[model samples]
Each structure stands twice: as C-alpha cells, then as structure tokens.
Target: MDTAYCTADGTPYYIANFAQLSESEIASKRRQLICVECRWPAYFKRAATSGQGACFGARPHAPTCSLGAPPSKKGPGSNEVQDILRNPMNHIRIDINYGAHDKVNGDPSDVDKANTRGGRFTGDGPRGPSPMNRRLRPLLKALIESEQFRNSNIIVELPRYTSLPANQLFVNFDAVDEGLANEFRGYWGLIFDTGMSADGSFWLNTGKYDDLSILITPEKYDDFKRKFNFQLDRELEGMHLLVLGKLRKAWSGKLIIDVDDVDRCALCDD
Candidate 1:
C-alpha cells in the first residue's frame, strides 16, 4: 500500500503505506495528491507545456495555464475525498490491485471497463499495461466538473499520485519490499484486491481513469530525513510488507499500459 507521486516541478512525492490507512487520513492525503495532479500545465498550450512535461497543467502546457501557483500542502483537498463521505466502506473495499491491473485509482468496477479500457498486468511484461497515474482522477474530475474545463478549449488527461508524507514512504517501501519479497519502492493510489485469475492474467481492468506522468524534484527526494524517522516502528513496517506481498500475488500479469497510448492498447484492438 505504498504510494508514490511527483510534484509539478518534478519532485517525488510519496507515502509508504499510503493506501493502508484509516478512511479519513487516506482521503485527506488523496486531496493533496489531486492538487499535485491538476497543478501541471495543460497539455494543449505550448506556453505552459513548452517547459512543462507532465499532462497536469490542465491547459496543454499554456502559460495561461502555467502551474503558476504551487499548491500549498496546507490548502483545501480534492473532492475525491468525497468518496469516503459518499461511502466509506465502499472506498475501503474498492480494491485497486496496484501494479497488476490499472496502475492505481482502484481499476474501475466491472461495469465500467470496455476492451478499450485495457486491464493487463504490469508483471506480465511490457505487453501489459503500465502503472497507474495515481494522481489524476479526482483532480481532473474536480476541474472538469468545475468552471475550469468550461473556461477552456483543450483536450486533456488526468494526473496521478499517492499523496503520502515523507516518513511514510520509507515505512511503506520497507513494508512492501519485505511483504512481496521483491523490491517495489513505491506506488500511486492503490487498494487491496479480492482474488487472482486462474491462468495468470493476474490483473483486473478498470477504464474509469487514464494514466498520468510522474513528477520528481530533487528537493522532494532530499527532504526524506526531515519528514519521518524510519526506524521508529517495526510493527507497522511488517504490516507494509505484508500488504505488498498480497498485492503482487493478486496481480493478473496482464499489462498496465498508460491511457496515452490507447490506439495501441490490446484491449482497444480486441
């Protein structure tokens, strides 16, 4: 349940056990994560996008849509936080199947995915889908649902993020490293899964969300020590690894492709 994210300036943002939290805390962090996602340059505008690479700016990289105002971690949260308020238990039970199915955003429930909504496993190799753009969903949804989209004339994708604190990254990474008996450093928004496929498809496909780019900055990574003491909790560390191991086992080994390459998606051709 470790989650990873990058800021608009390309700084890494993460929280190790980001996914494994009480509905309240996870929902809170998710709000911050959403800001990071939409804070980028909109893809269509060259001014904003000329220097900006991530598709989060909401205006196609136009200076008009520059990530001009950096998000204050202390600012208001994203509405996706509403999920918890809408149905806390459903939010808890909405298994995202990180790395295996969709990268994050808890792959869409059965009713949403179509062949175009490719749901392959990342473990299956390059043929599978890529990791989820954990940040985009709520942020994009909010902007589009608001006057933001109405105010512009550009096509865009959602941003992804995990919205974890600095200390939590180490705690969760260490958890999954041991849990899955592998070296998974981080993930975006992910939830626990229910079961795995028999033939090793090992993944689920929820097309409700599209993928996003990762944002990493030197400051974001270097500030780790200032965030949390990694050595403080052994019990929580054990829990982290346990969660990862289970997540790996449930993956369908299909593909975790990004939404950017939909035309090439196997599901699309199928």
Candidate 2:
C-alpha cells in the first residue's frame, strides 16, 4: 500500500504507483507523512531490498499499527486507499426527477381542467417531491460524518424547475450562510445539460428556464475526456449532473461554473 498519514494534518495521503516520490523528495515531506489510521510516522520503502515493491510503513521500533498486519489469503483483499476515495461525499450524487404533470401544453383541455384548480394543480400532481425535501437530511449527515466532505469543497446539484415547498430547498446550509460557501462552494441546483461544441470547447447548461451556460476550456475539456474516457454527448444528454466547480454568479445574474477538475463533476446515480 502506497499510503501514509500526514502528521501535520492527521490526514492520509496516497502515493500512486506511477508517481512515487524519490527517497530524497519523500524525506523532504517526511514530517508530513505518517500512518493512515494512526498518527505513527511512516516512510517509503523502494522494492529492491524489501521484496514488497513500493510500500509505506512505520519505523520498525515504532508502536504497532493494526493496518500493518499482513493480508489474509482466504478473502478478498481491501485497498484502503481506494476505499477512502470511494466515500460517498468524495463524489457528488445527482438525482433527476422529471415527472409527468410537469408537461406543458401537451395534455387535453378537459384533462388539464380536471387536474387544475386556480390555474394550478391542487395536489402534488407530477412535480414530485422537492430536491431539498429528499436530499437535505442525508447531506447533513454526510457533512457530519465524512472527513473528505470536510477537507474538500463539494457541490451537490439538485433538480431545477420544480416548485419546492416554501422555497426551503434553495436556501443555503448554515455552513454556507456563515462564509463557508467561499471555502466549501456549497450546494446549488439546476436542470443540467451538456454537449461538446464545434470549437472543441464543452458547453453546459444549468437550468431550463434561462440561457445560463458554462464553458469548459478546450484544454481542460480534452484532458477530462482523455483521463476519464468520458463522452460528453453520450453521458450528459437528458441526464442531471451534480457539479463541483468554482461557481460564480455572472454579472447577468446567471450562474457559471468552471469545471477544470475531473473530480468536480459526477453523473447523478440515483
């Protein structure tokens, strides 16, 4: 396992197999690297002598760390580094709910009249539950329990064009209200759309009601497509996305986010 803990922050850092630092480089940052589970100091060992290839471990005389134990041959092996990264908060979860009653100018007059009261549907009809209604509780839990959620800024995108109850869903979390939005880039939503432009730039839309757009630079666009093997046209069509990016409200009162990091965007799984 090419994993170590940062004594400075008590956070675990993974050194990928391809990017292992040289001994001297590792030594320079030694003060910041330690065991992932415990704060024990750790060091990188190159493969030649240890036969373990590249691995990280505490000094031989250091106190025992449970994760240092040898693997069991009978069961599936766990990759701790991958496990940490797989935590739900590390990825934004998107859920798009487009309902039937949301249709416009399609239903017959008789049917529409029957469902309408005061020019609006009397009951929930087809708009479905509000995004905040369904998502806020779980998100609050993630905020409390997930270390990655605390360390990294994230965006949780929700559905747009829905009539949320009392407009509660659009309100920012307490953290966001207290200047954390600048640090965490708190959740906001839109009916997301994406496509590749002819000029090789990537285009994104945040909502259906307006012409708001996001532009992914050609260089970053190509890099993400290559790194993730992502097909923007195929993946984003009619699919709602949860975007994590540097969000800014344009002078035109429209939102624009620049997604330079591949990890900043995720297709909503639910």
Candidate 3:
C-alpha cells in the first residue's frame, strides 16, 4: 500500500515512492511504520531491481485486521527462497536460559539497585543478561511497542522458572544432546519448507539439520496463512520463525512444536 501510519505520532502518511525516501528518511520511517487498518507493525519495502514497485505491508497483520491481504494468486518464484536463505541474519539464534534471574550469592549493593531499577536483574554471574539480549534489545524494544505484539508476552530475558515453567515458555536444544529434549523443547531456525496436512493444519520445516518443525493448529492455520500470504505449500520457506508451544517427538525423532496461538510465534523479515 502507498499509505502507512507512523508510530511516532500515530498519523497516516503517504509514501509516494521508495525512491523518494533518502537513506535517513527510510531508516527513520521504517522503524515507525504501522498498518492503517489495525495499527499493527508494518514494514516498508523499496522497489526491487526486478521492477517490482515499492509497498508497505504488515510484519504480522493483526487477527482482526480488515485490510490484511488474502493469499496471492501467484506463488513465489524458486529463487525467492534462495535469496532469503543466502542472508545469514535471516537464520536467527535463540538462547533460552531458564535460570537467568537467579540471585547471586553476594548481596545487591545500593549502587546496583540504583543503576538497574524496575526489577531488572542485577546479577552479573553466568546467568545474568545474555549476549543474545544485548544484541536483540533494540529490535525487541521495537517489537514490544508495536501494536500487534505489545499485548503478547514479549520475552527477551528469561522469566523466573518458579513462576513460569520452562516448558510453558521457551527452550533451546543442542544437536548433539537428545537427552534434554523433554526439558528444553523449543525450536528456532530459518524456515525452509512448509506443507499442509490432510486435516488442514499448516506445518513448517527448518530442513533436516535440527529436525525442527512447527505445526500451526488447524484453528489458527487460516489466519496465519493469510497474514503471511502463504498460499502455496512452500510460501513461508526462508522466513525466520520463533515459536513456543507443546513439543512432540515424532516417530522419526524430529521435533515438532504444536502451536495453538498466533501470539506465541514471531516471523521476521529476511
């Protein structure tokens, strides 16, 4: 769409063309882009070398967004997935430290509390703020403020395991260790394939490396399929996906996450 709402002032603006936006303008506007319909987070895409025109689209359209587009009539070209996979950033790394907030043996000094307020963990041990949090802070801030994700549980740092079970939130796994599968079951990776089940559920695959896949529950399949414009079976391949849900070990020993809510998932641009 040519028009988009800005998060800065909650005002609509007409983007005549991407070419008209300078680098600084693009960077500034892109961060605040929002969908005019549901006021959810949206992204601005510049015109491609292939002559495709510029447009604004939702990162993940709200469930009730009236302006959300239906699945495209034409499927993505073969090279589309390859192009996204070529970018290393599209393959996101996930860290799920269950005990990130454990109190250190040393007492918290007044300086520590003053420096880090609002219940921010002051522990400086190995369980303290992770490298992933430092890297993803800016993006997480943007996502948390975005209309679509603001209400969802935005978990950057791991919450207390006592309050929320690790299985109920997220878990990370190493390829070599299958023993901890039950404890740490969450899967994160670059999606490379997707298919529809005979019963109409949507399944996403991250290829054979980690043997990870996501099963979008049948009730949520339509909304997710439309939101991401996944008409064809493989439409969502190459997108970055982070999903939290029930983990099931398939007969083939692949890890499949059964997702019942759209809010527990985040799909990022390539």
Q: Which is the better candidate, 1 or 2, if ranked by lDDT?
A: 2
Candidate 1 per-residue lDDT over residues 84-195, each given as its tens digit: 2232111121112222333323445552243224332223334323222222223223232233322332222222323232223212211232243232222222211112
- Residues 76-144, candidate 2, lDDT per residue (tens digit)? 112222232343333333322112223233444543333222122223445432221212323433332
Q: Which ten residues in a row have the lowest lDDT in candidate 3?
A: 90-99
Model 1 weakest lDDT span, ten residues long: 261-270
Ranking by TM-score: 3, 2, 1
Which residues of candidate 2, in runs, are more than 4 Å off? 1-192, 232-234, 251-253
Best by lDDT: 3
lDDT of 3 by residue, 137-239 (tens): 2233223223332333433332221123222333422231344345433344345446677898777755334366678878777666655455555435434
Model 2 accuracy (lDDT, Cα): 0.41
Candidates' lDDT values, in order? 0.25, 0.41, 0.48
C-alpha TM-score for every candidate: 0.20, 0.31, 0.38
| Of candidates 3 and 1, the better by TM-score | 3
Q: Rank by lDDT, highest first.
A: 3, 2, 1
Relative to the true structure, candidate 1 reaches a TM of: 0.20
Q: For model 1, what is the C-alpha lDDT against the true structure? A: 0.25
In terms of lDDT, the poorest run of 10 residues in model 2 is 166-175
